[model samples]
Target: MNAKKKDPIKSLGIYCHVPFCVKKCAYCDFCSFSGQNSQTIADYFKALQQEIRSFALARFNSDVGDLAFPVVDTIYFGGGTPSSVSPEYIQKTMAVINEVFTVSEAAEKTIEINPGTLSASKAESYKAAGFNRVSVGLQVWQDELLKMLGRVHQQSDFIQCMEILRSVGFNNISVDVMYGLPGQKLEDLTATLAELMAFSPTHLSCYSLILEAGTPMTNLVKAGRLVLPSEDLEREMHWTIDRFLKAHGYSHYEISSYCRPGYESRHNLKYWEMVPYLGFGLGASGFYNGVRSVNTSDLKEYGRLIAAGKSPAKYEPPMSEGELMSEWMFLGLRKLNGIDDADFKKQFNRSFFAIYQEAIDSLLKAELLVQDGSVLRLTPKGQDFENQVSLAFF
Candidate 1:
């Protein structure tokens, strides 16, 4: 095998999946089960730590080649609810991480929390555990909507959570919210926005509701029990959020992500920047060098493989350079700022203008793309047609 083929990207982000929850949300299609998930939380953490240690050793043998080192730049704990883990569990994970990887002195360590699960003590403990950032999913402010979403927390709980987060010295807080639900109105989104902005979180990730197959939400849609707003209405609502947030000094760096200046998500940027990060645990996917791989989604299988001292990965393949380049365009265009021409040229040693001339011409002709210097970004019209513009790359 070629040595060049095995070299991963420079930076490392370790994503630890904590797939346990108190109650499953109605619209949730994630790899989470309420009681069943909690049963294995402790064991999963143990497996995850061992997996990271193995990956670190492999990287030392493969990528580093000559050095004894752990080169993780970020550590992200995401899940059904990472904060739902007992404080001791979180501490144990951090301890394992410290023992294995040489985390950056200023690494962006983060953990996801739900309002009901996160408390002042836990928040402070997380801070002490080296988690500098926390993202809380406060999906909707309306109690009715919260109930409908089957969220275990209330609007007051969200406020209380934020207060606790502040008291616990979590400065880099992120708020996650959603829109475009079957029963959601534009006014409802406005109310949600008002509540979120009042908290002045450093970062916000806004996701449109996606009805995944096998979920109750999908069943409702198929059964005609749910009627989603038309695409035009959804786009309109998205644009409204975009405009409002931009006006309020939130950097619309990504399609669904906004941040205060200097607060853009570093771990997420690793993805769009086409940097490789290790994904450990069930259902986690990662891109390293030109290769992409995903771990088995089954928790039992994951544990079995880890216990056997093996990667839980189901499939791993090296992507062709063309495929990698296409993915670069795909991911980069999702950022509102657009991709840089020079970076593309440097990476592929070819001009993007020459490569996708017809697509570019057609997009600009349709007034969907605004070409400013060597940069190309979607116009408001293009944002409305983002899917079509993205398809141009493929």
Candidate 2:
């Protein structure tokens, strides 16, 4: 008898990285820069379009005899700041994507914006270009904190941007805020949440500040010119915001993300669920068909590769089965609900407990994990040390 045939993967997510910003924040180490001429920006867009088309054509050619083309269920335009570019650039990219791929009728499209760069016309253009979700970066509420973080936008700018987005008929808006900043107080966070609640954004991503190595913020801390909040204070700030958001009708769906019912980020959830995605543009990464790939970070290199009709991917290594399982556990556990045992077994053809019984037993004994029937999740205490729990799988 012939062996059973496996099903082909479908329903991909597309991520486009727009590596431009009006100004680089002190804490940011992303591959984005400020102050480029219009010609440079225009050239980058041309290369980006060529790369998108080339990738699509290659994917289509590979799937020649397949029953159905892979459908794109989500598209995320992440930044530096996607809104930094002119709206026409966004429209042209969307046009290219639609020309090459089959975008699902109910696809979720999202774009990131910085309050300092968002304008009313741009907001309207985004809506017209089929961006149904908008995430605005409003790192903090206080002007002093904003300046300390080297953000160009003041508190007033964020409020005004929110107003513009609303007036332009954007219903699904997510606001990004941060905690654990230098000299941040509990009252400051509370006040920020209060003001944000007034806007009634559908989603909130409240992240704790991490002092990455070699960033300006880290240098200042090392030089004793800046002092971050104490660990206790940071923890307090995290839980305080979580509880407050829950009380205000936002579900803490993920460790750092809270959303109203049905407003969770579809594209980001794909990452946690191990769904395949295609990534375009400088420094973007993608995981598809058992392979993980990253585009080159250098603009000149990326442009050169695309111009030569070559793949701009700097790396494309297929993941081993063990690596895939480890990633599944690590990403799945990041969700507030944790990993589903049944789903794990279905995906890997192995029982979760059978593979990680010792690790599970140890965590259970340590009161870090709790098993409730088919689901395994982090305890409230475990959530505080999630890194430790995730490391167990490794």
Candidate 3:
């Protein structure tokens, strides 16, 4: 594993899933567990470390053929609440990464935390371990809404979390906010944004709640115990957020994300841009060399496979040219600035319009898409109906 590589290296992104949480939110279906014993937690981290080492040592074969070791430029630590774990685990895992891969000196290292799970000590440990960015999940500012959403933390917890992270010298902070809650109102959403703006986070991800099947929240809605905002009201809320954030100096860079200048989520951008990334930990997904792989979601199964010195991930075949082109259009359109036809041609070696001229013409006639110089972007109307526009490419 210590041997150097002969093949040329490619810049990559690394996503490490921390699948432990203090509690699972009612709406969360992500592969994470709460109430696991200390030993189980310990075992999981050991297996995770082993998985990382094995990937680094392997020839990294895929349908696209043999590839060189990746030089990681962005490392992201996400869900169930990375802050819920002991910082020692994170530090050790990072040590394994640095030992195996060629991490860029200026890599953007980020970790996601929930309110009430962070402390001065944990923040300090993360800082010392080379994490330069933190994303705090606040959900909503109202205590009642937080409770309704099954979040364990209160509004005060978020306030305290911000204070501690700032005091520990973490300036690249991103906050998560949710709208379209069961009982959320326009005023409530506005209040949450106004209060959060006072903290001046570098990035914000405002999302509309989607009721996933089998989740407690979805069952409640199905049984009519809870009610969501109407379509008209939800539409208003979206525009309100767009106007409010734009007025306050944040650029709407992506469909669901806004940020200050030069502060985009570098790791997340990799996903939209089709850049290669490797995912580790239970149920994590990775894409590289035109192949996609997802690790087993069952923790025990993942452990057994790793313990047996076997790969735990299931790999999909290389994506076809049509699949790649379709994905490039839809994913690229998620950005506010939209996709460039020239860049598309450069990658696929075919004219963008030559393939999708009919779809583009239809959307253009409907006033949902506009061709600005050489770029194809969504109109204001198209932004409101983004899903429909993105699906047109498919």
Candidate 4:
């Protein structure tokens, strides 16, 4: 056995990628595009079932079977849009997973639903099929900014979708909200927050817009056709969301996600804590058995690989002990509580000060961090410039 692959306290989560959506959003750089009139989704699910079956076979083939992750405690259906496919598709997918792996009865099962693709019947069907949580894309509440962000659903559509889920008795619902879009104003954010808070979702995720290089949004900005909020305004927008959500009794568990007490997302927490998880689709990533891998992003190439009875894993990097310790510190800082200094020493058999002596000393002098006992956390300014502080740990 590879000593580094030894199991730890963290449990595994399963992520099933639904790579189809009704319409592609303008600024989305994810592996998503239009899926109307395309049977690609259903075909991919069939291939995914095959992959799950292979996982079961691989488990049974292992020399030490019981030590393997025989049960998945959380299953996250991420996307494109899980709702675009029929409830029957999801049911079948769950069936295959049940047959292949042991699933915890209390497992947190979630599906991402796009507002334009959801209906009351489908929402109820998901609940019946054991989906305890639902996330809907309501990126912006204003119709004008919605159009600017190239979202397909109207503000009314989002309202209707939320109403449908609420009517179906879904209490654990989360909505996605975005900031820093072209022509967005402070009033725009306040209005959107007000409208969404009216629905009283259990969770909310506020994201800042990122204009990736190859996206059309970048092109418009380069041509001087689109305008974004100034740096000062952007900072204010972030601070406003942080303040409002906290006052409303939501926990900012991570940078972008906020939830009412006891309503935090279980599946996503696995990633932030650097726990082992499995990924099963094109462009998805997994960290398991001390090896991390990503599937190919190209739809055509991914489909081909799966059809040929392959798992389509790419860039499978095995992490070293020192590397994992560093990652534990780096990724854990993304949370509000920051990393455990004692945990770092136990894992590395060396003090945290041994590696990050200069960086920690510098940040402390700059007043960018606050240490309460052994917990080292970023100050407000440091959280705003997280990429810079996080680099110090490395």
Q: Judging by TM-score against the true structure, name the best candidate.
A: 3
lDDT of each: 0.83, 0.89, 0.90, 0.81
1-394 per-residue lDDT for model 3 (tens digits): 4523546478899999989989878788888899988898889999999998888777453334355766789999997889998999999999898887888899999999999798999999999999999999998999999999889899999999999999999999999999999999999999999999989999999999999889999999999999999988988988899999999999999989999999999999999989999999999999988888999999999999999999989999999999999999999888989999899988999988889999999889988889997799988888888888888899
Better of 1 and 3 by TM-score: 3
Off by over 4 Å in 2: 1-9, 62-67
Q: How much lDDT does candidate 4 score?
A: 0.81
Report the C-alpha lDDT of model 4 over 69-96, residue by residue, as the tens digit.
4457899989888898888888888877
Off-target runs (Cα >4 Å) in candidate 1 are 1-9, 37-39, 61-70
C-alpha RMSD (angstroms) for model 2: 4.0
RMSD of 4: 3.5
The segments of candidate 3 whose C-alpha lies over 4 angstroms from its true place after superposition are 1-8, 60-67
Q: What is the RMSD of candidate 1?
A: 3.5
Best by lDDT: 3
Provide the clashing-pair count of each candidate structure.
0, 0, 0, 0
TM-score of each: 0.93, 0.96, 0.97, 0.94
Error of 1 at 254 (Å): 0.6
Please write out the lDDT profile of model 1 over residues 260-341, one tens digit for every residue.
Answer: 9999899999888887777877788777656778888888899999999998875566887778877888788878899878
Sort by lDDT, best first: what order? 3, 2, 1, 4
